[model samples]
Target: MEKEHLIDKYVQGTISEDERLVLEKLKLEDPDIQKEIDLLSDLKIVTELEDKTDLKNLLKETEAKLKQGETKVIPLFKKAKFWIAAASIVIVVAIGITSLLNPFSPSLDELYAENFEPYKNVVNPSVRSDEDIDAEKQAFITYENGNYSEALTQFKALYEGTSKSYFLLYQANCFMALSNTKQAIPLLEKHSTEDTPLAIRSKWYLSLAYLKEGNKEKARELLTEVISEGGFKTTAATRLLQKLD
Candidate 1:
């Protein structure tokens, strides 16, 4: 196959494995082939972006105007100049959009950091009396004090002993605070399925857990649910969804 055709197929992501091997070999042999591939990849992005912007319509209008005077003799050189100028404009627009999309966009980790706070100790209000601080109160105190490891141990024991569903949520929050989304997600998922008052809040934290784990699709799914449920993190979920988009 011609190198040009291979490069085009590569940028379109329609190249077969054999063709990919050929292109890889060509890239190694001639660095200019890789540059051409990069340029074409950028053009493909620009083409898609044009659909969302007015650029596609502008180009079509220009073409229509150029084709209108079919009876009049138009110079080929003039048409070439017009197309060259249009191509330059398209390239410039592509670069601008790429820059805006790439550099300024917050990463998933950043979004997670910005959006996630361990669901506050609403389940267990802190007791100032210090006299009647039981295991449950102690667990919440540890969590509120940011001692996640001890809180996790306490919450796990409470959940195992009483099977109170809120303890599960607190345990998940502890895991999240410790940066252990792997452990947090399953607990949050299980808690979110219950009919308790904290179920919706569990979904919110689950979304954040997924976000922390770099699972945007699951995070988006939970965020959408939080928004549609119409309370408890709806506004925050909406804001997070906008950032993800």
Candidate 2:
């Protein structure tokens, strides 16, 4: 089946179970298809809402004309239209109230700031003793104290010394804190598909890195993937995608 045919069936709510599954999979893999579906849905809602408003206005006009005896007989078509319009008024009013109550106004940067917080030092002890520790330990202290430049330097040293993936995640976050998303992107991208604890988190942060870099398209792509994969980040990713849309 063609995309157009599938989409038509989707809109009509007549798609087979297998076709629905296939369309949903396509939607996940293709952002353009998802966007088209969203647009179609929105258009249908607005058209229905507008039709309701128009019907109400038309009924008022018709009633006024009838009272004034403007015309002798109401045409069969007018009577049918009037009854149809009256039947839907309740439904329309309910929909109108719901739509007015929940409006969508998404701010991408605000959402990012609200959602992005540096991961706590769970890999290390939350509280440090008086021991003179190594560079990695010192780096955590700098990071906790909000000295990102020093933290980045220390984290780089830790990576050079050990080549650990955790260090890369930490260093990438430091760059992000400094608003250096360009530098953070590659590091996060490296771990996004890995099986490490930070893998899913890396995908989330990578999307944010793209967002901060003004790459909305790439950000949306990653966020969509995060939503599809389904995890702790799904809700946040879905919210971010709404704003991006």
Top-scoring candidate (lDDT): 1
Residue 207 CA displacement from its true place in model 1, Å = 1.0
On the 0 to 100 scale, the lDDT of residue 78 in model 1 is 38
**Model 2, 41-71: lDDT tens per residue?**
4334543544445544544554575587543
Off by over 4 Å in 1: 1-100
Off by over 4 Å in 2: 1-107, 130-132
Q: Each model's TM-score?
A: 0.62, 0.57
Candidate 1, 142: how far from true, in Å? Answer: 1.2
In order, candidate lDDTs are 0.78, 0.71
Q: On a 0 to 100 scale, what is the lDDT of residue 4 in model 1?
A: 65
Model 2 pairs in collision: none
